[model samples]
Target: MDHQQLLSLLRQMTLDEKVAQLLQLATPFFKGADDAGMITGPMASLGVTEREVRNAGSVLGLSGAQQVIDIQTNHLKHNRLGIPLLVMSDIVHGFKTIFPIPLAIGCSWDMALAERSAEIAAREAAVSGVHVTYAPMVDLVRDPRWGRVMESTGEDPYLNNLFARAFVRGFQGQDLAGDTDRVAACVKHFAAYGAAEAGRDYNTVDLSERLLREFYLPAYKAALDEGCEMVMTSFNTIDGIPASGNAWLMRKLLREEWGFDGILISDWGAVKELIPHGVAEDEAEAAYKAIRAGVDIEMMTPCYVHHLAELVRSGRVDERLVDEAVLRILQLKSKLGLFERPLRGADPEREREIVFCEAHRSSARELAVKSCVLLQNDNEVLPLAGTGKIALIGPFAQSGDILGAWSWQGAKEDAVTLRDGLAAAGLDASRLIVAEGCGVDAPATEAQLAAAIEAAGEADAVVLALGEHAWMSGEASCRADIRLPEAQLALIAALKPLGKPTVAVLFNGRPLDLHGVADQVDAVLEAWFPGSAGGAAVADLLLGKASPSGRLAMSFPHAVGQVPVYYNAYNTGRPNVPTAPDHYVSKYLDIPNEPRYPFGYGLGYTTFAYEAPRLSAAELRADGELTVSVRVTNAGRRTGEETVQLYVRDVAGDVVRPVKELKDYRKLVLAPGESAEVSFTITEPQLRYYHADLTFASDPGEFIVYVGPNSRDTAEARFRLTSTV
Candidate 1:
């Protein structure tokens, strides 16, 4: 059906039916036809009637084609108009063949690989009967204390925007109207949920409109402009109003100004949360406020079902709101070709053939390899030679917690262990010794410690695999202290006495403080929850079968006190100088202002040399573009990949500006001692930033251009922008 046909369908729906289109329930609610207890179990707790269930527009957290077929068939039998249900899931990283977390993937600095990961995820999900995925969470994050930072690309809006567009293109494809393998993409936690105060989850957000427009809003806008089909409202309040019911954020800014006509949904239970947020009086008021704010769908909430119809009929809520929302949902279904084929893309045979296939796993392995950042490799202890006994210690040495969180369909049992990868890489098993040094966060007994000491003493070198448990870093899992658990630190401290050329392979979700590990270990390999193929990826990097190419998207702090440290931070009025710790500056007496490892910082077997940048013109016209060029050379004997980053700093602005902001980047694959000259074309639009009044424009002033492998240690040149207008 087309737009007019959808409008006609809306005209035929009863007020209750129209209201029900805004409601989404879980998979259990749809099993009532076969399981009689669903009515008394999930339905009772949900406070939804059987009539609402039949009329409900969508379902969440449901997988498998056969189950979707059964539920859709049963629903059509009960509904008057036979409208199909839109099935959505949290298929963030992968469906069955999981990839690295978004933060880890961002470290790869390869947008093409990022898109391929999303494409594989969407293909597996579409065949398994998922219609939409809440993915490409484009919130600009700086606080590592926020657990969901693992879901974001990084702290910079420019980088996050690139990822946002890529994920959307990968999920939706070029023509979602024709492709059954692609699912609709939903950019989530709309607006700045990432800037929660103290890095707490679902905490209130209060920022100037300037900062919101400049930093937090660009990635979301980029996703929507890239043809994302939906937007999920954040749980936090902005400008003292909950985002689910903030008209200025939803209707005025997202809809009226930005021209987004796609579906706007609430995060789970966020619509009814307006009451606790102290914005709504009751469920009826919540329904009125959400619809008024232009929210089209309410996930896991009955407020829309119980109160929307009554509110609309009583003239308290406009009926057009319901009609517009239902039409958008219908348009999505029609775009998916669901009206013609209600069981669209649901094929059990395809699901069996595609999910967890070798082709998908190969892609996952490739991404995981590129995503592992070699943080430290002093004395070149890695690429272990078959010379002597090697001891592999710690909890994750053989653990299968490689598939990180939000791998809804990924099998932990199938994940390749670090031991498995090392063996597969042709390591002599006779010379390899393995032991559980300690639990991830639990102290080992005296006997366990003694056994670990014996294993290390017998070995020539040691590899300690350590990290936070897989459960430590998804939604609502925020930690006030972002460091390794005491038990793991104790294990590190215990092993420090051996003085072996130790390599610590970390498997974590967020960038950690690395207090005991980084300082103690000879080499630190940040193998962030490497998903199904994580072990193989780590093995390849360690054994020099593949070079480590991943960079840091988010910064690793020197201490937990530097929770929100990032590369593109503002130059404070009283900037801290490393030479003057006692000066009256913005300095911490105990810790430095800089991060332990700055953004874009990573390592490989080979070293890189960056020449000073050269500008095309000393003075750039406001309407013209400026080209900055630099030659990067592989200075080591090993072949490697280098990500040449371009950054700019406005010397002065109307308001405060960041010390440096990422403008463009290039990733080059070079043979040993090869050289490549990379160039970036900087446009006036690229130089623009939001002022205090929230006007997006560029200033005619001096700008410094820096080119390097990472955010820090860059070679710089100067240029000036002149306005012709």
Candidate 2:
């Protein structure tokens, strides 16, 4: 259908029908009642009748080919205009053949792998009848206490923006209208959901407009620029208003300024939440506010279904607003060719063939290996000898709960345990001594601790697989104390006395406070919830079958008090000097200001040495580009991949600037004894920042460019920007 046809369909919709199009219902609403033909489940409390349910434009959190086909088929039977129901679900990481969580994927610093993961997710979801994936959550996260940080890429705006684009491209592909394997991408938590106060879920976010535009908003904008089909409003309040009802943010900024004509859907129950946010009096007012603010669909809520029609009839909301939203919905349906084929890409045969297939699992295993970060390898304890008896201890040693949260379709039983991975990698079963040291968060019994110690004593070396349980992170699972449980710490203490070389393999969702664990273990591998193939990947890295190339996408804080520690923090008036006295400075009395591990910090089997940065010119014109180059050599015997990062700091600015901001980075594969000159072209736009007045332009000033392996340690050079054209 073309624009004219979509408009014609919208003109024919009644007030109730049009309002229903803006409401998304769950699957139970359409499923016929058991025995008797009465409608059942949670649909009654929604205040929606049978006709309203049939008229609902979309279904949330429902998949499976036959299920979707039956739902759409039943809805079309009762509908007057024969509009197909859109099926949407949370395909954040993967559908069935799960990959590592988004945070783990971010650590890879491999955009191509990120894109491939999204593509695999899309293919699997599309076959199962899912039309849109609420994914590529681009919120910039600094506080690990926020459970949803597992969904975001990381703290750096530049890195988040890159991954955002990659996810969108991979999900929607080049042409969403024609691609059968691709599912529409919904870039979500629209504004600044990641900046929740105290890192609590659904908390208020109070940020200066300058900071908002400079940091939080870039990734969302990048996703939109990449042609994501939908945007989900965050549950948090931006400034003083909830994002679902913020007209300035949704209409003026997203629609007018960003020119995002795509569909805007409210997060789950966010429409009714407007009343609690103090922005709306009741459901009626909430519907009016969200509709006026340009929300197209209200997910898992009755606000739009219960009050939108009444508001329209009372003249509180213009019927044209309803028409405009319905048109966007119809347009998407047309783009998806839903009217032509109600089942779209839903095929039972395809679903069976693609879900958890070997090829997809292979990709997952490879990417999982790339996502594991080698945080510490003191005395070269890693690359464990395969011939020796190895002790695999800790709760995750044989646990299959390696799949992180938000992977609703992934089953824990299908996961590869570390012991299984070791065996698959050709390690002799008799040589692998496994013990459940303790439960993920539960206390270990004396017998359990004794058994773990004995196993460690018998083995040549110990591989401690420790981390938070799968339920510890994701939505509504925030942790005030982001540290390993006391039980795990006790297990480590018990094993530390064994006098054996121990490797700490962390399987967590967020950056943890490893102050104690780091000292006890000879090697530390930060594996942020590797998915189905996590075990295989861990085994590969352990036996030197693969190199650890992943980096820290988020900074690992030294302690819980440093909740918001990041590399690109602002320089205060009294900055702490490392070599000078700590009096009257921005310093912590108990600990240093630096993080346990800085952003982009990771180690592989090999080592890299960086030469001092060099600039092609001392100064650059506004229209010209300056070339900055650095020579990096693999200083160790083995080959490895290195992420050479380029960061810039403005000497002076109209607004206070971060101490350093990542601008560009290149991940290079280097052979031992070989060196390569990595060059980055710096243009005037790279130096531009949002000023106090909200003007996004660069001011002529001196800038320092740093080239390094990680943010904390770098080689620097000076340059100048002449003017802004």
Candidate 3:
């Protein structure tokens, strides 16, 4: 049926039917379970039967081959409208075969893997009866102290944009209208939710228009360009206006400027929280505000269900708005092929067997290996090749704390611990000396430190893995200081004097102040709390079977006081100038106003040399394009991968811009003495910015493009864009 025909059908429906299309329940209702297996009081109250919810709008947190089949079958055979229920869930990282967190995946700088991860996640999720995933969170966060940093791909807009499009492509595939498991992808947190005040989760986002467009909004636009089907509103307030009810953001920017045609869902309970935000007087008012502002669906918030109809009747909202929301929701279902073959996703054996199959597990392991970043390796102490008696010193060396945040389904029982991987890798458990140098959060015991020191003296090399527990940097787990908690640093200091080569494996969700560790340790490997096969991946990198191609997502600060340390921050009026006095300048008396480890900074076992950037054309018109190229050669003995980063800067603009912005990047694997030419095409959109009136357009001006290995170190070339319009 044509979309207009569907809209006509929706108009013919009765008021109760139209309102029923807006209802969303928490979980799926199964028929026999009410009186047979799992009897409960709530099941009896709402006439909660499998038949009832299957007839409703959609269900959340329910999927599996058999389960989805049963629900959709009911929709086809029993529901009044014969509308297939749209099943959705949080496939943040992986569905059943869990990969590393988004932060770890971001380190790969390999958009291919990110895309593949999303593809596999969609495959598993689709087989399980899921029609949508609330993912591809493209929030740009600068502060590592923010707990949800693990969920975002990175702080850089370019990297986030690339990953966002890749995720959309992977999840929805070539065609969402034809594929059963290829569900619609939701580009999240419609506006800036990452710049939370004081690095607190869901705090107010206070930023100027220049800051918002230049840094935060590009990635969401990128996802929309890729044909995402939904947009999730953020939990934070933008400039004193909660995002759940910001018309200028949702209606004006997202809908009008970006031309996004999708369902807008509020973050869990954000609609009702408008009362707390002082924007709405009550739940009824919040429903009115959010609906009027263009939010179509309320996730886990009863405000839409309880008050939307009342608002429509009271003239607070137009009835056409309700029909528009319902139409968007139904159109997404049609695109999911729910209308054509409503029971197609109901294969029981395929769903059960596909969840954690061998292929997904292998991909997870490969991603875990690729996501591991070697921050520093001195004297080539890594790739511990020879079969020697290695001393693994730390509680983490044998623990099951590798699962990063949002690991809702990953349990320790299902994970491969470090000890298990070491054993499987043929390392003698008896020969591998172990010592709990210190607790993850407590001071190091003197006796434990002595045992580790004594073991280091007798070992060929010491593998000292230190970092936070799995619960340290996720949602609601924010910290004032992101450092190696406890006395792990003290323990490392104690074992350093033993005159043995030490390889430190640091595991954490966010970046930490590791200046002291970098200064002391001979080698450092940043293996974020990887998922189920994390141990095996770390072991593979340690043995040199897989090269570490990962890079940093967030900047490592020198100390906690230097919060929000990132590469793209604006240059001060007297940047890098000798401060006349600390009081009058943006300088810290005790610390330098720079990052400990800059964004895009990562060291590989091998080295690469770069030739000066080559531009195809010296000038570009506002309506035209240009190609920027560079030759990268693997100058070291080992064959490895290097990420070529591209940064752009507007010399002068109507509005002030950052000193630099990451525009594009590519990861290349090269053999020693081999060189590869990587090029990126720049269009007018790359030069566009939000003016005072919030229109996005490029200004004819001089611009500089830098190509290099990371954000801090780069080679540059200048160009000019002529005004053609």
Candidate 4:
């Protein structure tokens, strides 16, 4: 309890206990109050009595460890200054060994397996007592009609700032106040809320503060430069205010230009949603504009427990802003020692021997086999054969709902499904044949399409298992037709006239519109919502015992009017050049401007190639650095894992840039006919950006650099930066 004992417990709390420590509320308002304690359900019209439910301080969502040790042992038996509460939840992507959804852990460009799935979801939410984990939602999404783009980690801002510093160093582990198996990582919808407008979830986001500091504030400033101890605030509205009231985005750019002295809070109920975002004229002017726009808590709102102690006793708010938000919530409950262990990592026998054990389901089956992406295989119809006869048809073939949609303690009866991963891979239960064939978007009747076309005309391989319905993709689940579900496309047009072979898999959560199930599948994959050992990592990547090294961290659009299609866009002024095929360029007269799967596409059951980008220098300067290289190889006969990527582009940019951008990548692995090389140093702060007077820098010209395996088949070269420090 330092900082002079948290400023002597914030000079003994009371302006209604420091406005009930900025108010949070939930866990059924301290489990359905009323023995004159009053606070009933839905926070009883927000007039919450019983002294703001015995000084709220924090609770939201709530978790287990003896239900947060019986709500901090009944709020320390209503004692006036004990202060323990805290709790928090929505442990995005697994609190019970589920993994694979942060856009399939950003298609496994594995940042150390996304920091070991955020350190095994901060050790199963710190033994189920959860001390904050709104989670690594580093919103940079290029709109997949924003149903929380499966809790973002895609459309690259340098790959969502490297999975937002690998989920804030795997949920604040390097000592988030001395980690008891860590948890305090709240980096969320703060700034751009994934540019909502029309991609729509909470709506309005206008952008251009140089595209919100070059692409949605670099994964929330790389999860507050990886120290992440909470941030939240974002129900949308940015350039016209609302990110929980905005004050130049939370007090002049997050506490005086990004110094972010942690704990901000507010997203659910977004402080009485500033009166439906017409910018408040109620709940005491949205609790005086979210505590003068710095919002330290206020989650399920009561507009800061009904107008923060009458706006701090009518001085128009400022009891030193409620003693600096109760001294950053008692300096985060004295850096979570919580006045010395108020059930810190609450045990319950370590939450039943660590939630889903087996070394967290073997790191959720090795991050669901590097988050399965394969995309399409064609004449080489995937590895399948474990003595075929297969045909596991639709409705997630023996569904366990594959844990998507903010898992919330995952456990569709301890998930595993595709017929329990092909009977744990030995396969033969009379050669498999499964078949729910209908419902992931309803309609399959004609006797479930003649028993899925007579079990794909008596199987010799079918696999199918379709998509969407873990409530069709996270938060408010968007999708204005993100395709694939006309009764799983009529059970894939009644098993594509049973010619056999098939494969598909899918199970989505955004980035779909797979041009009608990629022309009736010969292979496909794209397993986005694979969690809880997603059907034993899709039967070990369909019997080859694993390989499809994921990839496509967002960009599948073949159509949904290409709603914000991305692979680093911006190249117009009449550009669609096929040596100038014209009707005034930027083409799209009915399809084909690219992307049906691009941004670092994916494929791996062996095939690499590459070799054409070289350049150890053609000029760099401003504290020089250059490098480049390429090589690649595997070229087929098995062993895989590629990634490569790189990107760049500048050539003439006092402002119009992104015709390419990613910047750096690597991944590799290889083997058959082996090869390697790879390189990429480049420096000058990877050609800095944010210009148009926002001044991030880097100009003196000519860049190019490509080197690919994905952003639309690359291979270029050419250098030059030569100035701008």
Best by lDDT: 2
The alpha-carbon deviation from the true structure for residue 325 of candidate 1, after best TM-score superposition, in angstroms, is 0.7
Worst 10 residues of 4 by lDDT: 32-41
Provide the global lDDT of candidate 2 against the true structure: 0.91
Clashing pairs in 4: 417-420
Q: Count the backbone clashes (under 3 Å) in each candidate.
A: 0, 0, 1, 1
* lDDT tens readout by residue for model 3, 701-725: 8999999988888999999988835
Tens-digit lDDT track of model 1 for 573-655: 78876665547888887887899999999999999988889999998897888899998899999899998999999998888
Residues 147-191, candidate 2, lDDT per residue (tens digit)?
A: 999999899999999999999999999876688789998999988
Candidate 1 residue pairs that clash: none
Two-way lDDT contest, 3 vs 4, winner = 4
Could you tell me the lDDT of residue 76 within candidate 4?
A: 80
Q: Which of the predicted structures, 1 or 4, would earn the higher TM-score when compared with the native?
A: 1
Compare candidates 1 and 3 on lDDT and give the better one.
Answer: 1
By descending lDDT, how would the candidates be arranged? 2, 1, 4, 3
Give candidate 3's TM-score.
0.91
Model 2 misplacement above 4 A: 32-39
